[model samples]
Target: MSQSTESTTESNPFTRPGFIVAAAMVVALVAVGIVIFLLPKGQSSAEPAPASSSTVTASPSASSDGGKSICGLPGSAETTLGTAPQSKWELVGRIATPTDPKTFGPGESDSSGFRTCFAHSPTGALYAAMNIVALGSSGSTDLEQKLADKLLVPGAGRDAAMRQAAADSRTTGSSTPIQVRGFLIKSYTPGEANIDLAFETDKGALGRTTLSMRWMDGDWKVKPADDGTTYMGATQIRDLSGLILWSGV
Candidate 1:
C-alpha cells in the first residue's frame, strides 16, 4: 500500500500523451515502489487482489453552495477549522477535479486550504485528512502522527501501522507535498464515508485506493481495517520536478 503527496511530470520521458502522468509513474514504480491496491471484493483474506484501472472524470458545478463563497463545503451544517500540520508538511493548496475522472465533486480547480475539524462535506474533509496521513515528516512532533491520532480509528495496531509506514526507510526521494488528482466516494453518510483517492508522488509514483471514514469527535476520521494493504506506506521524495506519466487508473 502506497500513500503520499501527489505529482507526475509533464515532459517526462516515461510519460505519454493522453495519459495521466501520475498513472504512468505508478506503473513504472510497481516493482521497487509501493502499491495502492483496490478494495477486496468480499475476500476475507488481507492479500490484495490486483491493480486495475478505473475511469474518473472532473467534478461538475453545483448550486448546492447557494452563492456561499467558501471552499467546496459539502451540504452540511458544520464549521471547519484551519490547522498547520506541525509545520513539517507544506500546503501546495487544494486542487480541483482530483486528476481522476471517476470521482465526484463541485466543479472547481483550486484544491487548497484544507481544514481539520470542518470540511463541510465528506469528500473535502476526507480528502484533507488523507493528504495529512499520506505526507511524511521528520520533526520531533510529527504532524502525520497528530493527524493519524485525529483522523484514524483509535487503536494500538492502527497507530503502530501508521507510524511504521511513515517511518519507512526504503523510500529515497523528495519531501515535496503530494498532488491529488481525483477521488471517488463509494458511499457517504452523515456519520461515515468510503472514498477511493488517486494521487501521484513527486517521483512519479501513482497510487489509488479506498479508505473507510467515520465521523467522530465532530470530525471525519479514517478508520482503515486491520488490513495491511490499506494505503501505501509513507516515504520521502527527493525531487518534485520529476516526470509525470500515467496509463490508466
Candidate 2:
C-alpha cells in the first residue's frame, strides 16, 4: 500500500508534463517583460523635446551716414559732415521733395539749371554752400554764369554781384569745404522753400545765411531772395555764431 501511495504522489497533476510546459511559458513571459523594461527608447517609440516659443530677430541696416551724400554722389565728405544733418532731415511743415539722392544722380539733369542745383540732399546743399564760397573767391565768370543759370536769373550782372559779395565777405582767397553745424527750415511751399543754415569755415570761421530755394524738374534749386533791390542776385554770408570746436573742416 505504501508503494502504491508513492506512485500516486509521483504521478500528481502538479508534476504532469502539461503543467510543466505551462510553467515554462509563464517564466518566458516574465523574462520578456523584464527585457522590454530594460531596453532603451528608440525613434519608433521616443517623443521629441518641447520646442521654444520665442522667435529670433535681426537688426536694422540704416547707418547714421546712410542718407548723406555729396552732389547726390557717395563720398567721404558725407561721413565727415559731423552734425550738420544726419541721414534724415528735420522737416518743419511739409514733407521734403527729394527723397533719394541716388535717383538725383551727381547733380545732373536735362532741364535748365546746374546739375548740383537740383540736389535736395543736405549734403548736396552743403556741397553747394562750401563750393559757392570757393567759386566766389575764385571770381570765375563761367562759374557765375553757372550760378545765374542755376538761380534761373539774368546773367548780365551775376559776375559783378558775386565779385562784390565775395569781396565783402573777405572770401577772396581760396574757399574751403563747409562744415555745417545744422540747418533750419524757415518756410516751405509746394514748389518753393527757404532755409537758414549755420556753418563753420575751413579756417574755423563761423557764419549763418538764409537760402531761398525753388523746386523745378523734380528737384530743389537755390533762388535769389526777392528783396527787389540791386543785390537781388547777390547773397551774403554773415559772421560766425560762437567758438568753433570742430577742426574737421
Candidate 3:
C-alpha cells in the first residue's frame, strides 16, 4: 500500500542500499517508531502457499471489465490505475540492505543507487500477487511498468480498459523509474507477495533485499520483514541520505 520513490536527485530518509547500514536504520525505526501488533493467521495463516503459474483466478470483487482479475485474483481486473487508494494504511516499519556503490558499466560515472520499499502488512495476513518484474536494464519505462502491471494485476495488460489507461499515464510522462532489478512472484492467493529487488545507480551497487507484502483494502501492501522474528525488518545502512565522498590517499 505504501509506494515510495527513491530518486537520483532527492534525499530519501527511508531509502538506501547497504546491508549493514540498512539493518541499523530498520532496527532503530522499529524499536522506536512502530507500535507493533499481533495479528491472526487468516491470510498469512499457513505461512505462504504458492500456487501454480498456469492458472488465473478472479478477484472476490473487481470493477475491471474482463472476467479475469489483475494478477489473477478471483474476479476481473479492477480499475486501480491512478485511482489506487493510498490512505488508511499505516507506515508501521521499513528496512534496507546497502552494498558498495558499484558501477553499472565501465566508464559509467560510478553511479550510486539504493533500494528500499516501505513495509505495510498486517501481523499475520498475506497479500498475494501472481507475477513480479524485478528491476533490470530494460531501457523502456513503459515496458518496465507493463511488466510490473501484469505481475501486480494479472489480466490487466490483456484487457482493453486497463490497457488504454496505462497508455495514457505513460504518454503523459514521468519523473524517473525506480531501477528495480529482480522481480519474483511469491504467492498466487491473497495476502502473499515477496519482492526480491536491488538498486543500481550510475556509480555502483546500492543495496538489495527480499521484501514481503500482503493485500489490504484491495491493494497490495508491504509487511515488516526480518531474517527471523528476532531480526525481523532489519536494515543495513552504509551512509545517510547525502552522498558519500571518498578521498583517495
lDDT of 3 by residue, 149-244 (tens): 322333322243234324432221112222322223333343454543333322322333455554544444334322111012333223222211
Give the TM-score ranking, best first. Answer: 1, 2, 3
What is candidate 1's local distance difference test score? Answer: 0.38
Instruction: Write the residue-wise lDDT of candidate 1 on 106-211 in tens digits.
Output: 2233223223543435444444444443332222124434444545677764666456445533322223333554445556655666665555645555455456
Candidate 2 has which clashing residue pairs, if any? 107-115, 206-240
Which one wins on TM-score? 1
Q: Considering lDDT, where higher is better, how would the candidates rank from best to worst? A: 1, 2, 3
How much is the lDDT of residue 177 in candidate 2? 28
**Cα displacement (Å) at residue 231, model 3:** 12
Off by over 4 Å in 1: 1-115, 133-141, 162-178, 201-205, 227-249
Residue 196 of model 3: what lDDT? 35
| lDDT (Cα atoms) of all candidates against the true structure | 0.38, 0.33, 0.26
